[model samples]
Target: MKQSPATPLPSPKERRRLREAGSLTQAQVAERVGVTREMVRAWESGRTNPRGRKREVYAKLLGTLAEEEEPRRPEVTEPQETLVEPAPPAPPLTPAQAFDALYAFCAPALVRQAYLLTGRRELARESVERAFQLAWQRWPEVAVDRDPAGWVRATAYEYALSPWHRFRPRYRHPEAPPADASDRALMAVLLRLPTPQRRTLVLYDGVGLDLPETAAETEASTPAAAGRLMNAREAIAARLPELSDPAELHRRLTELAATERLRAAKPPVVRTGSERRARFWTRAAIAFTVALIGTTALTVRTAPTHYEPPIAPGAEIQGVPERVAQGPLSEAEVDLREKLRGEMTSGPVRLTPLSR
Candidate 1:
């Protein structure tokens, strides 16, 4: 047999209204539909819709419920067709425009947050600018992010709290304390807290993010985040008793951030700077690669094709003849030789005597 046609359901709100009108709980609907209550709730809230066999079942159930709940009206004979004007579409923003908008909206706040983290006006400005610069470099990823501000904020915070900044000459010494003594004390206390605790407190108490959100942004577990918040608050309260209240603490943080006139650079300037930095690095990389290739080519051209063994050093020969040495004759031996030559008694003397 051919399957029956699938029933159509109304909008999410209408479905909810029909179910409520029929005095049925979500649990009851879920039980009848052979799914979980959360799934039914998701359908009613439009987070998700049922699909496949479940979709047909859900649609049929909701349709029957809608028919039962909706009142029937008497038929009227008139032209039922109505001309409805369509809504105009909004103009799309250019990538540059969208990036500027995001920068303008998030930059100042991020700068303040960085100042709170680092307590250095110049460093704070640098952090926010750097974060925005990175965002511009990765604009495609940043643009599509669900929380672009949070992304920038996290980046700024990371840069601000970097330990390597302490090694920089300019950042070696601390910035001048806030003029107000109370502000000075609060800043000292905040600076004393560990980086993670301070960040957690700022995100939770100052920025008003929920615990889970703070934890996620800080890359900490929820319990760890909570502990950090608790510890930071305790430390702050210990030093400054009046800021024991989280709200009051938040207010003080706001005031502390506002104490300095930390202004962000213009969006266009930031964008241009980011582009310039990217181009410079790209050129540097290309130059490096070309140099490496040239060096390799030169080495290959000059390299010896075959291995040559080194010549061995000379050695002394053993068996060579040495000169025989003579001793000097004494005076008596010389006289004897002269007398024997003069006597010439032998027969051969006559032949040799004239030669002597």
Candidate 2:
């Protein structure tokens, strides 16, 4: 069997100092390393050592943080000759205990994440619940994944983005939209974006995922995801012009996600096979129609119009208007002629009465 490496991890005490020096909280470090804050605290306190791939990830993430902050590295210490003490063995978590652990730590944050994608509170809750339900069904496989929470999170994001949910019954509250005008405007712009841009922005900004993870979640290449993110950010900046920097936008999104309180709804009744198929097809049709309308609208909005102003009856002809005859004899024309006989007609019109 291939062996896990024996390379040393950062010492827990040293890591804690480094994390603090980087102005990172335990939770932030945990997120960067794809672990829970509790686990981060445990590692910092020397209660547990991250093994295998996790140790490697931890080391790399900490190394990056150290580089960013330019924290001083600790000097190597001489090994002590005294006998080492072995720590007591920890109890293994049963399936239920494991599920509870993952769920409790991840549910609130995942709900916030789902809300960013779906923009519907009940749908977000349902999406998260559906992911957890699947996790419960395959706890064995999930528990062994390198990042179990990441798996569940990816499923939740997919569920939130499912087109069928748009047609599903909504449990919308009267005051569901954000109360702040700026927030409401920002959300309006976000929800209007194409699915790719919205998903990339939500994952990159709202969930604090790095570019690679955002790209993976959106099933896009790094450059493609980066383009989507840039487009989304530009749209947002256009709407929220006060956000002078990307960090401020990220902070605003974080606050917005927290403000989006997604309440749970009662479980929906099971559908028959035919009804399920019908729902799927109906949603597919609606999505297709919406795409068509969006394309047409975009074309119409971008195409220029050539307007022709209305011309009055006596307005000039296409090239040059025909000159009026010198000997015109109509009543109005003769009256004008008699009037022109007066010297005032030689230049601009005058108010003097014409001789009878």
Candidate 3:
């Protein structure tokens, strides 16, 4: 039998928007449509289109979503009963309130995520706290961010995975593993993976983010992220054959993370700490600048204004005769001295006689 033409669908963005508006995850939609989550992502991204039975099902799902999303007008006949007053809008949230709400909501999950990344309960909590502290310090930027939770998550992940942390005295020793043998083995395998691959796996499998989103957060190309994820899964599956399946792997990861009882500092504490840190740094910078200015001024005041030639050091005269003690004069030296004296007297004797 000849089939009818395929149903016309909306743009890729519209398709994604409809699914999101319906509060459906890509995995959920993929399950309903009998396709892989990657396929769903491709369809939504306009990279490829679904065909045959899946196309019809996807189109129908979108139609239903569109219908549900449309606003229905109340019947005109129902308005004649009683007058009603509209409720007043709630007050806008203060910066502190907004920050607190964000922290409270994201901190718990972030702590768990950090634990999975670092396998250290204390460091996990600390990473989340530090990330939130930084976020609070840059509240204006974070508050206006498209996804504040994502921003904080990236920061926490970066901190947790930093190689520098290994040098810290407290973190130099590994934390104790989970109580269960399976959990211990799983964590050991996870810690063996390279940082990039491990982060990709956690963001994609553990956190349930789509491929592109995972890549974006990990700061890798989509293909690179996919490769890392594949390598990571293979590595995990090699160590624990039971977790070979992606679903099972995800479940195991969740269970592994759940084993840790991580908690974050309260929002007030985080905010106050952040403020204190900022103030300390600011004061230090001001003091440094003031000292620098004073030193410069003092130097200018004490510096010499005119150039003066330096005096040369004294030196002995070349070819000068050395003095010797007087001894008995030689015969020739004595005779010459006497002859010169007598000659002078004889020349003057003729002139002196007439004057006397």
Q: Between which residue pairs do clashes occur in model 2?
A: none
Order of models, best TM-score first: 3, 1, 2
Best by lDDT: 3
Tens digits of lDDT, candidate 1, 47-131:
4567778988888888888778678898989977989999999899999999999888788888888888989999999999989
Task: Tell me model 1's lDDT, rounded to 2 decimals.
Answer: 0.88
Model 2 worst lDDT run, 10 consecutive residues: 265-274
What are the lDDT scores of the predictions, listed in order? 0.88, 0.76, 0.90
Instruction: Give the count of colliding residue pairs in each prediction.
Output: 0, 0, 0
TM-score of each: 0.66, 0.54, 0.71
Please tell me which model should have the higher lDDT, number 2 or number 3.
3
Off by over 4 Å in 3: 1-28, 34-81, 309-356
